[model samples]
Target chain A: MLLQAHSPRGLGSLLLMCALGLYLALVASISLGPMDISFSDSMRALLPKQSFLPSELAPHIEVIIRQVRLPRTLLAIAIGAILALCGTVMQSLFRNPLADPGIIGVSAGASLGAALSIVLFGSLAQHYPEVLLFATVPVCAFIGGALTTVLVYRLGSGPNGTSVTMMLLAGVALSALAGAGLGLLNYYADDQALRDLSLWTMGSLAGASWPGLALAYASLLVLGVLFYRHAKSLNALLLGEAEARHLGVNVQSLKRFCILLTAAGVGICVALSGMIGFVGLIVPHLGRMLCGPNHQRLLPLAALLGALLLLLADMGARTLIAPLDMPVGIVTAILGAPFFIVLLIKQRGRIS
Target chain B: MSIAIQTHQLSVSIGSKQLLKPTSVALQSGQLTVLLGPNGAGKSTLLKAMIGELRASGKVEVFGQTQKSWRSERLARHLAVLPQSSELTFPFSVREVVELGALPLSVSKLQLDDIVDKNLALTDVSHLQLRPYPMLSGGEKQRVHFARVLTQLAQAGEQAILLLDEPTSALDLAHQHNTLKLAKLQAEQGACVVAVIHDLNLAAQYADRILLLERGNLVADGSPWEVLSERRIEAVYGYPITVMPHPRADYPLLVSA
Candidate 1:
């Protein structure tokens, strides 16, 4: 007996531990930076318990912690949660562990949408200085993402219902189409627009702002609760679409709802942090290995693990080359790809 | 006996090819009906059509109500299907897999657990309850699915219909008999049990009634002694077979001649 499947009571303890670990990672991410703020100072700066605490240090710490690091840390948690939760749902919906939003062209579609907004609306931003550019990009991205998802789903479905293989093929074709659109936008861009496009595509927490942070967190909470309630249905889906139907799950509606919601969530995350890859793919597998394949336990744990990993990755990006921030996407890919490969090799015996 | 399922001119077709011809039949409660046919003979197609999984040309009713009229959730409570193979991607334990059968029910947690536990033991999979479904042997996996479908019908009352598609295809001799015995036991308890099976001997021994299909047509429907005759078996199956009485059992025994 592997004895690896934890009891419900054991899973509760594991969740509590992961929650504590996530909190510690959040604290560490806020405190340690190029400025070398002490852990206590970071906490104090975050929560101002004393009004008069060494005025010079207080103001410096306050500026760094509040204006810069605080928003970044919170955005990391929200985006990470969104990506991982969506990944869990996508994997179950598609009936493949390898599935992620990227597999279905949502990320590519969002990137195309963002590229369009940045290149097309560049002049508009200057003329309409009062208009917030943040709102425009995400709205456009959401539209693009939703359109691509609907297209893929339509192409994949025929008289026999949704075909996972057809969906994958359609996704690849759409990703290529979006890539062409991005290339065209790249060609039409000026130097500044080109630079911004590159940075956004590479992905960074450097763009984190208070408003963006608030939007990301709000989406996270709402989507998290909704996805959590659907955990059992997702589990039934793992038994295949027909089996799920036999078990009284509304297979067609569940597939439609999950796909659209994931598209929306991934669209917002891409708009806020750009194209961060592999966090969605990697964290859900880790959650499964830790807590078994029960989605009731898997989804929440995946969210926590995703948040912790991304926060740590962002921290490494911030400090590894101090004063020159690396794109957090690179860190996630570097960390995620190797772990994914090792898992593939380990499961190779059963691959057939 | 009350009719558990009644099909009026139900037929299935794909493109221009008719898989099952228009056929009318009534399956009664307190009986186990086994569907026997050669490959591509429309046995599975008719079973799927009866459960409304496939679109048929005519009507199917469960307990005097149209199959289409019942909500899927409510219908699921009265009818359970064990497909030939269930595609599972995750590592669900046998108990968890069994517990999924209670999804459509509004039963309390204790009642649900009792149903799952009872079905698990009924299928003789109680010892394997903690084992991962994917890790089980082919026969064990079949039994786990058997437990799942059985649990699904636990609350469906006397008029319930259970459809099994090749429920013993992967099982060994002992397990095959054990599974059919459980199906018969369900019928004895007043649930209408139907199975599509390939084994002639098993069908002869277990089925209260046998339905023999040949190339999209029902050629025979009667008791085992009436349907499993040597001449008809050879004609429908296109192979020579020997039919003899079992020495210690009250059923016919079949052997290839």
Candidate 2:
């Protein structure tokens, strides 16, 4: 008998369904904000065909939909997809279910980098603000993430190869170090810098701009294709490191490539969206549960699921308290923790 | 016959505790060599050293190239190893797990499937092809791994080196023989097959040559009839064991005296 749920055609259909749902979520997010734009009006504003209409007819509805909500919604999708994809890769890399960018200290490292930018370059940022915002935070965040990934990998790996137990423990220790560094930055920050740091740590897509949207989507596209190419190698990896080696995979190079790419992808996401928690942690499991752990299927599917989940979470953050938009990170944690608990319960006897 | 594996003064040590003493031997194709040893007798270590899975002193050459010199992917095409136990972290279907054996080979889709199918049937795991690997019993897992290594060797043609550590340890009576029989067939087909086994009877029945080890040293290496004498068995295994000629075959058979 065919494994019904795991069949490629079945999973393809599920992915198509999620893609449709994501379109619907995108429409809902654009129209459901505090603005008085109707759902039809939002849709028309989004379509290029309707862009020729009179300004009076659509009013500032164009501004509200195109300028305000569109970028934020797109950012949500891009960041969501990026986080989930990185999480899927990280989980496989560590061979542990609990590995996530945020939980494993990559996000915390990024946060520390961002915090340094706000505190150290605060005055310089005011003079040439574009340079600081585009250069300092993203570069430092990428470096921080790359360093932490290498550190964690080095700390966890032994003569027997990488130990999942050691990786998890290293993640915990690094996260703690990041937290203390963040606290120290907080102690020294000016009032405005402190606010920026807090907003970043909590994660918000409210800072979405056209350039940021372009970067996020570009990163997602590149990472998706690159990761897909490594799918078979990743499958062999699931058998065990030694077995993967016997299968002719250059395990060291594969690990290095994955770790570097993921760190860069995760660093960019964190730099743009702040430390959005749980999407990376939860989305991979959700994808694995629906499709099997086959990376070829799981990576793209996880990206779609992550995009859908983040868009929905962003929607909740926007409408949860009306005019005061809650942090999207909060929404993700609320949804993710319960799912994680169920996973833990199911895997209680098996976790090592 | 071409030599498939040659080890010169090869030895493994971890933190100054020697696991395998310096051992020199040449394993030729068309021979099923069984490594028989008691508990902690360094059989697995010696096998790992030969395969370059563990760092060892001296040299290991596969098909004239040093084990360390051949790129892993290139070496993999000519060599395959089945560790004592494979740690399957995911719930991969048995077919998927077996297909991993074809990772080093650039076979077409149909050819890979043919290879997978033939080896799966050969190991009697065709029925479990679609089952998740983690759910299989120990014997089934062992057989699946044997199939994987065999699949790897299938692509290597003749004169490939097949290193198996305890290939039949978890198998039932019939499966144990079936597994060793496959190894014997691989050797007869001109592959260099070296297997680490505990069952003296199984080794005696299947091995074209037997190498006995004790306390990190090679005690005896010869044909089953020559090396499996009562005196040698007692000295190596530290037990009173009687060796008798198999009633139906020319090989020796052992039973506790």
Candidate 3:
């Protein structure tokens, strides 16, 4: 019985731990903000508060807590989850651990799209004058992400099938093209458009709103669940194609489904948040190290860890400079780059 | 009962190079058939063609149905194959890999686990269930794959056919015997087992019938004594060899000439 438990029990416990970790992280994210609100005050603000508040409680704090931090935190969680899920799927699709949403040129494409929107549409100053810059950026970002993915898929796939190497190389080529396009757009942009484009390129959750939050979070959850159901197929695919086929998996269909789901998830994430690098690459690897490579465990665990990592990074971005805020993307890169280096160093000896 | 597999004048070419010439073979139910050939003899190609992994110019019938006539998923429910080399990129446990074999069954986890456990125990790999597949030794991985193949065979109902491409290449002597014995047991249980074997001795020891291929052509097909004679082995394998009785069994064992 103990042996059987070791074989099966560990997986269940690990899943429970990931769930608990995600829940605690969510609570922490909702509680922490620039206002230094206590857990109780945060909870009170979260719920519909009646007339029992203190007289010194500013009306703006309620608005800030409800409208700003809540939506931002929720968006952070959703975007993080989507990035991690996409990373896991992409890694499997390419059969390379280095593969990520960025490797597929989605980030560059989205960035260029956002940059073009900034240059061509005269920034958020001209369009949606009432809304902040953050809210409008996601619209252009998503369109950019989707269009780039479609282009990359078409350019990379042959009549026979999509080659992982071809996709990676195509992504690199397109990324350079998009980067050049972005540079040209930046060179020609007005001062305000340039500033907005630069900040968008840097990535910030400051633009998160209730509508954007609802769309990103809902799609992330839905797609995350769908990818979770695909865990078994992904696991079978760890074996080569012939072996996977013998195991009764429809390899081509699974590949297409995984690719599309990954594209949609990553597209939404890039649209919502500029280019949050390494979360996709690092989170899935860490999850695999902790929970083994069973995607049933890896997917959910990676999602939780990615959300927690991003939320923590966002908190650092907000609090590190006191009143001034840095881009959350910079914070993730600062943290994730070193960790990625260490991972590479550790894997250096084993990689053949 | 219907024939499990029938290949009629099957021919395969890869980039102007003929890998397998026009050949015809019929695999019947409840027999452990061995495909004997040296390296680069196109045995694997023929097996892949039968499994629809490669395009062939001839007709293939699976359980009395044309290969093209049966849907892929439906064909999967009746036939399973273990290719020559399969490397896992991820760290899936042995149990997880074996459970994948039940994918065709479309059964629940409980049912899949039951089948996986049964196959694991049958292949003597139950103890390695929780171990990562890549961490296992070469022979252990072979057994694990055998267990996976067995799980697929079990879930594939009656009239199921199995194609194996050198299933014991990485296995040691004991494991090789055990693996082939298990495949023989599967055959006795009414499944057709067609395996490509390099070791003529193992073929003579276990095969109900042997098909000899020489340079993409079927040179001979019959019982071990008829197909594995000294002259025939020398002529097909293009090597000097001697055929002698096995120490423990009456089957002919090939020795270096």
Clashes of 1: 0
| Model 2 chain A lDDT-worst window of ten | A1-10
lDDT of 1 at A71: 89
- lDDT string for model 1 (A45-88, tens) is 87755566554565878899999999899999889889999888
Pairs of colliding residues, candidate 1: none
Assess each prediction's global lDDT (C-alpha) against the native: 0.85, 0.85, 0.79
Candidate 2 chain B minimal-lDDT segment of 10 residues = B83-92
Query: Residue B52: error of model 3 in Å?
Result: 1.0
After superposing candidate 2 on the true structure, give the runs of residues whose Cα lies further than 4 Å from its correct spot.
A1-8, A47-52, A57-59, A126-129, A157-166
Off-target runs (Cα >4 Å) in candidate 3 are A1-20, A35-40, A52-55, A103-105, A121-174, A349-352
Which candidate leads in DockQ?
A: 1
TM-score of chain B of each: 0.97, 0.95, 0.95
Kindly list the per-residue Cα lDDT of model 3 for residues A187-287, writing each as its tens digit.
Answer: 79999877766765667888786777887878887988899888877887777767777666788898878766776676567656677887888898888
- By DockQ, the candidates rank as 1, 2, 3
Which tens-of-lDDT digit does each residue in B133-189 have in candidate 2?
Answer: 777889999999988888877668765888888888777998888888888888888
Q: Interface RMSD of the predictions, in order shown?
A: 1.8, 2.8, 3.9
